[model samples]
Target: MTGIKDVARAVDMSTATVSRALRGLPGVSDETRVRVMETARRLGYVPSPGAAALASGKTRTVAVVVPFVTRWFFAAVVEGAEEVLRDRGYDLLLYNLGGDEAARHRVFETSLLTKRVDAVLVLSLKPSPDELIRLDHLGRPVTVVGADVPGWATVRIDDEQAARHATDHLLDLGHRRIAYVGGAVEGVLDFTAPAARLAGYRAAIEAVGIAPDAALEADGSFTVAGGVRAGHRLLSAPERPTAIFAGSDEMAFGVLRAARELGLRVPEDLSVIGIDDHEMSVIFDLTTIAQPVREQGRIAAQQVLAALTAQYWVPEQVVLPTRLVVRRTTAPPSDG
Candidate 1:
């Protein structure tokens, strides 16, 4: 079988340089990385992973746990995470909770532990107090995305801040009567994002010396359909709010649809702000606070690898940043 030495000979580089390049170590430069890969491909060289693991005490694998792979946000996170992982010579093992609570328990109880991975990366899988403690027993490195996990490290956006920014944008646009649309329990412990964001919205309103009306806060599912339902509930009331802060971009799109159905024009009849900056947000011209979802995923994987490799330790909490992207969907509310 072709080996690193043969590839090194073909590339006219030292075997040690070839080895480091192939292993994705930092000492290798971009040119050397390319040269090693080209040489390996041309020579049909495949490294023995099992032997490598035995020598290095690393499987070169990481496990990712998430629920509801169908959502655009989660999928984006995975895509961003996968690119970084593959580039680092690390393979990914994916587990989807598939929206089943029983399946969730089984995964935490079984699948995550038995893996030959050097680290574990989780996206919004709400491990219970017990489950979190149990997961720590795996004795592998740990990192999380989108929510808090005390013992392990995390990479996430400031959910409350993101929500507050969205709310504050409406306030800046002179929207005193802004309403909020958010999600209820979806059986995912990782689903605390919405609730925290709701708190942010209320805090913003209270800071302005305005009483937060419970009637103006509506909850439903986290999909477009759910947004439509919650939109109706908020807008149909006798004292309808002139602006809306949706927890997700999907929910914001639903509010847009609801406005049209009710003969209301966006920013003309009602201004809307949302979080996540969903793909449709740009096309729909919706204003939003964009969370670095994909970046968070990539960083989460990197943090896990750092933990496993003992390179450096970051803070227990790694908070990703967010910024507001304004578009045509939001404007100062009409006095009429």
Candidate 2:
């Protein structure tokens, strides 16, 4: 059986140096670390798990906590984070809170405390002050994606800015009677995103010399079905909006269906835009504000890895950018 001793001898280094290099500890130069790893691979050397654990005090695993695995954004983020963790010789432990308050409480109170993970990456789930306190007590490195938390590393796009940009696109297209289809202010998960987007939409409308009309707003619940319902409500109104900005691409799809059912031609009859250029965006030709959801996950994972490797790590807030993507769904309103 290949051992650390054989690898040490082949690399002409002390066993301590070889061990440090293999486990990615600080005492070795990058060049030496690379050489030791290469030799270990060639010799097919495997370190004893017990010995490795004793030396590094690490489990070589990361926990990823998310609200819903079925959502495209959450799934994409997980895929990106998993890719990074896998490449770094780490295992991922997924904890789905299932949008249940009980499940969420249990995860923060018990499941996480018992897990042997080196770090944690939280996706789109905002922790309450009490939950944050529990997390701090765990003493594990944590990185968050999709929302900003004090004293934790985070990766997120500027939600308000992204929404404002989406709204601005419609405003620029001569759209004044604009409507918003988004999550309800109180009931939705990821509470910060929906609120911020709504604020942005309002800000843009106000900046264009128009007061935001409550009648023009509808709650889409951030889903296709919700969008369908909201779309119907908005379109059936006595005074329908000329343009609608949906909080998500899925909701925008619902709006499109509603329009088709009403015999309203997209752009010609009702210009629509959405956030999150989902995979089906191309097929639907929906104009949207695109955020790098997968990339945010990858970067958050990277920050977790960095924290694990560093002797002292400071929490960072990384804000990525979003851009408007023009497609066939948006245009000047027919009345213009």
lDDT of 2 by residue, 85-158 (tens): 99998889898877777777778877554447888888876788887888888888889898889778999999
Q: Model 2 lDDT vs. the true structure?
A: 0.89
**Measured by TM-score, how close is model 2 to the native structure?**
0.87
> Which number leads on lDDT?
2
- The alpha-carbon lDDT assigned to residue 6 of candidate 1 equals 95
Candidate 2, residue 253: how far the Cα is off, in Å: 1.5
lDDT of 1 by residue, 1-336 (tens): 898889988988898788778877678999989989988998999988887777667789888887778888888998888998998779888878777777777778775456477787878755677777767788787787888776568888888989988999999889999999987745454587877888999999998999988899888567899899988888888888899999999999998888888888888989998998888889999999988888888888777767766767654788878999999999998879
- Give the range of the ten consecutive residues with the poorest summed lDDT in model 1: 183-192
TM-scores for every predicted model:
0.85, 0.87
Q: TM-score: which candidate is best?
A: 2
Model 1 lDDT at residue 249: 93
How accurate locally, in lDDT, is each candidate?
0.83, 0.89
